[model samples]
Target chain A: MAGRRVIPGFGLSLGFTLFYLGLLVLLPLAALVVKASSLGFAGFAQVLGSPQVQAALRVSFVSAAIAALGNGLFGLLLAWVLVRYRFIGRRAIDALVDLPFALPTAVAGIALATLYAPQGWIGQWFARADIQIAYTRAGIVVALTFVGLPFVVRTLQPVLLDLDAEVEQAARSLGASRWQTFSRVILPALVPALITGMTLAFARAAGEYGSVVFIAGNMPGQTEIAPLVIMTRLEQFDYAGATAVGAAMLAVSLLLLLAVNLLQAWTRRKLGGA
Target chain B: MAFHRILRSFTALALITAALLTQIAGCSSKDGDTAQPGTSLTLLNVSYDPTRELYKEVNAAFADDYRRKTGIDVRIEQSHGGSGKQARSVIDGLQADVVSLALGYDIDQIAAKASLLPADWQCRLPCNSSPFTSTIVMLVRKGNPRAIRDWGDLTRQGVSVITPNPKTSGGARWNYLAAWAFAQRNGRDPREFLAALYANVAVLDLGARGSTTTFVQRNIGDVLLTWENEAYLALKEFGADRFEVVVPSISVLCETPVAVVDTVAMRHGTRNAAEAYLQFLYTPQAQDIAARHGFRPRDASVAARYADKFAPLVLVGIDSFGGWPQAQARHFAQGGLFDQLYGGR
Candidate 1:
């Protein structure tokens, strides 16, 4: 605490922190709210009321939720395995986890398109098996999962690594089974991190465009997601329409993820007490 | 060693940050430059793919002669993407002074939003403001195994044709319109033709270049409905023997429009240079160069220069269908015939 006196101190640090966050995040978001508000109530109702808009909202939310949920489950397992035990090429596997983050979205889209098109490698197999993926809603989910996995794994890795082992032992000593130790003792400690990871993954997947477009076939009201709808509006030079859709998406996405945030806060309160 | 290691890590981090910042900043400044009075005005022509060679030769000539006449620096910066996407970027405030996209409808979109163009913008310049025109043709593998002679051949089952999404790619619209126009001309219902043709499509790509790459480069599909210039470039690049260009008995005229982004022109005070740049595109020299790139020259006299290269055919204008606007509204526009076909399917 005394060392803080040598630094910028409490007042200046607090002011600088707020200023930085305001400039980087709040200012842009405020602009969106202001710009969107300019559409007025009647205009917004018309934009949101369109059947195409509703379809896009459904596709964006459902696909993003599916991808984030898939990531949370698999990412937890991958993070746990990496941390709890040793393995060959562990560093290489860890590096591979970050590939989606590093690869350009357009390049990823092109690669996914090539890999999943009807005549392409995996598509050939799927075609033979009579299970279609590319140019379908399933392709959108696959691309979203591919891009959002890194967020969950990276978030959960440290949480799992730092988890206290004695809690599990203590639970077992109380005659609790292994499943009980995991479910009751260890899982509570991980809830905040898991929820946070899921929220980030969902947000990332919701706005994703490039990777999905190639695989989606861009058929309106079919594989078209909300971002594609916005892109379509933009292409048509429908500025009001694009922003109208974007603002509606903003509201729905915030509402959809409110539960995860509340869960995170609850977990934080529990962890603080522990 | 410890000090060197720390220095190396800091240097690497700085380099990465610099690289990323440079890229972000490069896209940030759309176009903010003015030639001092009496200096050359550099014109940036951000175009779609395959214009690299065409623009290189045309810009060189424009710089020399424009400098000779007006002493302006005529620089053309052409970037290509799927046409509709490119037009969307332009509309989303890409600082393009002049846009020559793959279709006229995209230019009309810019005009609608920015009020940067006249109602008859395409006709503002010579030859309906296009200065050059292309036609859609079937790009088949060497020997043309599909034996596809016209648009009707594509409707046969299991054809596995490839085209870019019409909603996104300007070139793809021409492909869509050509098929639609042919169906209408042949007295077949547009929906019937469209449903069958779309069913034959195995893949939909981002733009003409992407679709062409899949067809010519990867050798994927039976027939690729592509821009004539792209087919020519493919033949020129990938040996003419490697692929065959099958001109459909009838095809839609792909007229690309060029225009100055007006507000940008007013702000930059490059109005004279911008207008001059567009007019220069129609000159015999430019038209001949366009013909070389497989675009039919706007000038009949200049087109004769490449007479040996062009195959004889009756060129049909959109005048038969009341030009582009009506054609677009009737065939491909939202709630148009496309939806009638795709919706039912």
Candidate 2:
């Protein structure tokens, strides 16, 4: 097997990867599935069909999607700015991009909640207009956006740095306008990375608990997120019901990410072939 | 170079794995030492939030008394969280020798789920096993800008209220029941009153401390529904110039219950110490300490000594609402009054 291998120690590395993945990821997921199955199909259906559960799932998915979309656009602009331009505090800004990753999620939740509460520094202005932010659906989106920002910015930064400026120069030398050059050339080149970043951000936001709970008021059927609902069920000592909700969330997230990855792969292949 | 990179990565992974294994080993070895015969005994007291100060005083006093009496060095470890969360941790094997929680229902959950104590465990101590009691009171901004004086004022349109989620917080359950009791006493429909009052709630925090932070630090709501001790603590900590305590005309007596976990105490062979520790809470000295810390002492003389500190008000007990089990099932359970009030919104 060693003689036939294209790479040396492939067997060892593969074994290590499988062992680590199985121990950390697959085993816990399998346990969750088993726990959920104890509820039976009808019981699972009943858990998902509850109006409060349905409302929480909607809040989680919709707010996560909006946050991911916001990150996609702003994150690309930030990556482009950092890659293509030199500024006074370029190194400082680059380091700051990873702040969300280093900060604890609960701290971020509390900070965000404080900053957006009605009497807070920024919230007082919004309060004047009678538009509430903290303890509302919009507050959940803000916290998710804070935690998910780094995924997009960090993922696109490397890709943006690798992009050749000569391609854009050539487009400019031709008759293509700025919009056409960006849409036809630069955007197509970045689509695969952008989608990857957005998918990661969306998945993270969907499962976020600590940050959202602090700001989300947690009014059932109004601002409660799916993860909080699972926690609430667990607190009620309804383990099977909690796992059933968790399994449903896991299935949906997996399918959605799978679809996004498939799209990214297709785009990559077409561009490479072209 | 590729082989060197792989080797370096594997070395790092091995170091991380070794570190994690050592931590786990350290935890198990510590657990093993509890059963060994020794002159010194350690007990874990799982309690709810807002009782940290009260317990700090009680534990220190108890430790000194125990040392003087039995000459046994007793170390009491304290764990605090939302009462229901604390109870859940006990049920999930937290090895709590005693549970001093914000409400009796939380202790009842542990009784039903983990068999830590029998269902009639509350009968072991006097006053339904509640050493000290508090009541639901209002904390308002200084000068009472909203002029909110009673539960009815909380339902006014422009007044925003702050309280925790009842499902997760034992203190919030008392707040919810207090409002219900007040409404009923006032000849108003309890359900309608609750619905209107909750509508005025700008935020339903996860626990009592979170609600306090929202009301005091963040300054979000016009009024806060919280435990009587918590209100006084906020007033003392934040200064009377910034906050004021309002004793409503009628409120529910928020009894904080203490009980020994028989299974845990027996397992650790610390049953005697655990029972003695709880029994100590009922002493006149401990009751005085409870009163000084803003709780209504159960001991009549100690309570009278601090009567000037607490305002006079009518307090309905949990028995009037058919006890903890029925109240828990009817009011705070899923699809109960709480769910109908907030979920329907």
Candidate 3:
């Protein structure tokens, strides 16, 4: 009885799930791996070991991490407001969160680049302060943050809405401070959702090219992203080299995502036990 | 929590389904259009960045001319992007009946990699299969406040040069080589001169149009090193009062080549139409259209008619550096001269 499932046709659904993922994701990844492997192990290592590629990868990974962490914090606040409060134009505000998702990324990148150029309205203020945004690593972060925001917000919205306010009230009634209520009573349950949201945001930002290309200064060793490095290789007609970089990105992304999943599962188990 | 999980999965599934549906629709829509070719014909012109306006006029004119000549309605579909990218698409099964890329090396690549056309495809047409030509030039703010006139002026301390990455832009490869040619003609070390010039570059946009935007729209760079036509287009599109074109003392001749993909054209039964279309580019009528669009016409009459539009310079052909293949391998290839220019520092 305990093992009996409420949903029927488990095997059929599971087969469909595998088929869908195989066709959409695994097939392309397999092709990439095959192309990258054609270069041989030494050739692959040589392609990935270049300093320019290394710098680009470092910039890409670090910026994506920063962008994801930023989205996680701000997205939490946004989701909290949408779920916790009712105000004038709340529905509009709720719909506004999806604009980043709806707007074409290239258009978003162009708009952001225009807004952040030194002569631009927002950038002129920064220019006065002698701080550059567009054509810098900071600009890459800004574009990534813009594109990844919706991922964090959409992922957290449901989890935030499902969060019971009674738990916080009960904790406060028991003489716990507000911070205590948040940190002790509420945060643990939100931990899994928050990590999942951040992971999604991180993944989205890591693979983002359309929005970052226009904003990134694209100096080979300085502001270039890993994806741009792949493109540069492709432009030179180095198919194997391009796939080598792509395979590296894929492996790194998979490992990071796997780590995040394990972390999420551990937190869920720990919470369930607690 | 269970309900939320289901909702999230449903949304993901729906998005995936929608994407697949669109993909199917896109594929199916292009499938049968060429099956029965008598009533109407389609020719796909895979081209590069700045040729959008040029081909827009050419394609319309050619469609009309073809219908009048053959009594068959012809629709020429145009696809434009970075030169190398467009070539790569054709190699990767884009089914283009004709390719008018920004450089011969790109067409050579399609021939070498895909074998869609013969190795001597350029010899198939006149003027090395280049119906038109252009030269690299400097675009500066009106009055030329920086007084940037030549390649040497671009490397000056205060002049911020805006040019696309050579690896991505066919025009930029010409820009790089023209600068190299200038250095060589002046007996300066080409590599050092290029290093200094790149040091003055404000941004390395991915393509020619992007660099034009960086210079003209974003107002970042002091001077833009670009194809002459693009510089002219920038002035014509964005007010000429704001900027001016500076013809350098020496520049590389950019012979944008056109070729019919023999295999694809034969497969699509568009061989005759495709060949005629390319041949039409050499006509005086089309040469006039090319001149108006800022391209240097091959026809002497058309070129003389628009003489003032193009400034005279010692135009160095690609043959001066062996050819496109050798030049590309030495300069734009991985660990080559262009990469070495900005590599370590």
Candidate 4:
């Protein structure tokens, strides 16, 4: 009786879910793996061993990590402000969070490049301090942050809104300080949603190409990202090498995402046990 | 009640899936139908960036001439991007009727990968399939602040240079080769000189126009190594008061090649219009338009008319480096000199 389903079509629903997932996601990904394998093991090794490819991979992963971490923190704050507060223009602020999602990435890239160029308004200030932002690694992270922000915010907003304020209020009444209430009470409850948001942001940033290309100066081994390296190989008509790099990116991203999912599941289990 | 709700959702989901499947089937069937040419002909001209303005004028003139010659109305659709990227699109089935790219090698890729044209496609047109030619030159900041004069000056310690990546940009390959040609003619090691020159490049854009924007709009570099026509366009678009074009001592004659995609042309039945369109480029009227747009005209008389606009510099042709095939293999190929030099991060 405890495991009985509410609706009686579980078998039908499960079949539909598996069929849709297999057709839409699994098939395309299997095709990618098949194409990559056609390159042969030695060919894959050669592509992965190139310094340019290695540097590009490093830049893509590191910048994506930094950008996702940044989004996770700021996105939580933004969601909290939107859901917990009743400030003027709060609705407008809430809507603004989704702008990055709606705006074309290429347009966002151009706008960011303009705002951060040495001669631009914001860039003028940086230039005065002898610091460069556009066309550097920092610029790549900024572009990634711009594109990945909405993923984190949109993912966490509903969970934050669903969080009952009474829990915090009760903790406070029980003589728990504000810091303790947030760190112990609120944070644990938010962990699963936060991890979900961060993983989504990280995955989006890792595959981002249009926005990063405009701001990333594209200096080989210095600012070039992995997707751009793949594009370069494709342009050179090295289809096998391009597939090899793509497969490597896919493998790393899959592993990272799997690890995050495991962590999320573990946290959920711990919370349920608690 | 719960069972009813689940049944309702399942019905809705099934409807959506059926609709999506039907839509997919419709799209696939539509694509399988072959395109037919009608009385009014439409040609897709896939060109590289920086040729947008030039092609606009050329297309307009060609359309008028074709209409007057044959009672058929011609409409040309233009698509532009980085040279190699444009070629890749053609290879990936963009169905371009004619491809006027920045380099012969890009067209060769389309020929080899898609069988869009024959191996000796260049022999189909006059002037080795190049309608017009330009050379690499410097667009410097106002007052020549860097005091940059030639290819050697570009390698100076403090001058920040802006040029596109040679691997993706056909214009950049010419820019790189022009400098290499200069160094070689002066008894300097081409490799070492190129290394020094690249060391001063502040930003390597993916295409010619991107580098132009970097230099002219962003003002990030001291000198921009770009095609002569691009430099002219920059000076004309952005105030000439803010920038100056400096002709280097020696440069490469960059031939802009054109080819009709035989497969697409044959399939669409626009082969006659496509061939005529390319043939029209060799006309004196078309050469005049090319000269007006800063491209060095192949016709001597049309070139002479624009002699004052162009500076006389020692120009080395691509043939000097064993043509596009050999040059592409030796320099821009994967793990070649370009990769070896900049591969290290």
**Candidate of highest DockQ:** 4
RMSD of 4: 4.3
User: Per-prediction TM-score, please?
Assistant: 0.83, 0.92, 0.92, 0.92
Q: Which of the predicted structures, 1 or 4, would earn the higher TM-score when compared with the native?
A: 4
i-RMSD per candidate, Å: 4.2, 2.7, 2.1, 2.2
The DockQ of each candidate is 0.18, 0.48, 0.43, 0.54
Candidate 2 residue runs with Cα over 4 Å from true position? A3-9, A269-274, B1-38, B343-345
Question: If both were scored by TM-score, which would come out higher, candidate 1 or candidate 3?
Answer: 3
Q: What are the per-residue Cα lDDT tens digits for candidate 1 across B220-282?
A: 679989988888888988888878888877787767778877766656566677787788898
CAPRI grade of model 2: acceptable
lDDT of 4 by residue, B229-275 (tens): 99999989999999999998999988889999988887776888899
True-vs-predicted CA distance for residue B119, candidate 4, Å: 0.7
Question: Which of the predicted structures, 2 or 4, would earn the higher DockQ when compared with the native?
Answer: 4
Model 4: per-residue Cα lDDT at residue B193: 91
